[model samples]
Target: MRDMHESSADFSDSCIKEEVLKEKLLRPARDIRSILRWGYPKFSTIRFVADHFQLSLEERHILARVIMPPDRIISRINKKIDCSEIKDRKILIDGYNVLLTVDSLLKKELMWFCDDGYIRDTRYYFSKAKQAEDIEEALDAVLGFLSEASPKSVFFLFDAQISRSGELAGFTRRKLKEYKISGEAKTSKIADFELKTEGGNPESNVIVATSDGIIIDSVKEVLDIPACLMEKMGIEPIRLY
Candidate 1:
């Protein structure tokens, strides 16, 4: 049954990738023409092209316009747009949920605990090391993806109980700040209560990033905001929206 499930997931992923490839191949000639006419080869041209193609909402929303560094002439001709016009959006992330999904930490620990015999200790240490590596890589991937997406603000909230170590807490705070993200440690003692209290008007514009069924229900009930999970073992969110 597990094998079958894995096979099905692989097939679904392949189908999604194929669809993205097809969309990429169907770029509108008019989009190129418009870019040339305006003499400004901005990434927004991709949005215009996607709209022209009547792409699916999911694809259109996630589509990022890749603006290459223009040649000397185009660079000189095109002026940078003011930042004021850009919509400032915030993302509220369920930190422990994201960490579990990305690193499979709980699953690894469970496997280690369930192991037996003389090799158990060695296996446990090895899994811990691997989990650390996985967490670091996942963090880097997620931060990089979010940075490229260009949201105005991102707030990541983690359960303080689960990440009680000062070193880990400090590391998360510093790393997120380095990426211009506002990271908060929510005490497990009042996790949901804090979220409910903070989930209000201006935060209404915030998108909650989590896949926990209960968390999703609460966010919907409180703010009716949009949400998405951080992709772990598959294509990044930028590719899928």
Candidate 2:
């Protein structure tokens, strides 16, 4: 799967001085979708086609992530549940997945608005989330919403392999308590299996809150927490709505 994206060019990251021009590059990326529907090719190939336009390295990555998602992935995204759908349901959160994304957005970091209409943080999350200063606030923001969404319960699952995941699980549970939401967190060696198996039960009123594409594909419904939070804050992301 890692072979799906490749470093195409050593395009300079100097677009900070030309933000307006950079936005126009999205036009070419939009057209790139025509060929992408055929399959997920190396970003190098797309870069070869886009070379004439002089796009920055970051711009190219954004375009690739947004446009190059496989057709099956797009089909799954259509089943993503909305905030309204979770009003009376329970939510199973891929803990780090949600926290890392919210923290990145809160810190004004670069995020990708992909073809599936979901905002994604391109950073290697497991390494970077530990370095973020607002990790607790990110957790609180997510929990606060579940409190209001009136879900029957919420389950937060963190990967045990990650550093301080047990600590994160404890913190998440406490936040749930403070918010008066019925929920708890757990550290799992196989969180993917745990979520996929438990959330797949048709009799359960469980909806998952995560941006992990693989996990999302395994479940019946997913809720986009950051998108909901941003909507409440009146920040409309480009093409994500």
User: In terms of TM-score, which candidate is strongest?
Assistant: 2
User: Measured by TM-score, how close is model 2 to the native structure?
Assistant: 0.80
lDDT of 2 by residue, 151-219 (tens): 888999989888878877887777788899987899999999988877777777588888776777777
Error of 2 at 106 (Å): 1.3
Q: In candidate 2, which residue ranges exceed 4 Å CA deviation?
A: 1-24, 40-47, 50-56, 124-134
lDDT of 1 at 9: 71
Worst ten in a row by lDDT for model 1? 111-120
Clashes of 2: 0
How close to the true structure is residue 85 of candidate 2, measured as C-alpha lDDT? 68
Error of 2 at 20 (Å): 3.2
Clashing residue pairs found in predicted model 2? none
The CA lDDT at 130 in model 1 is 26
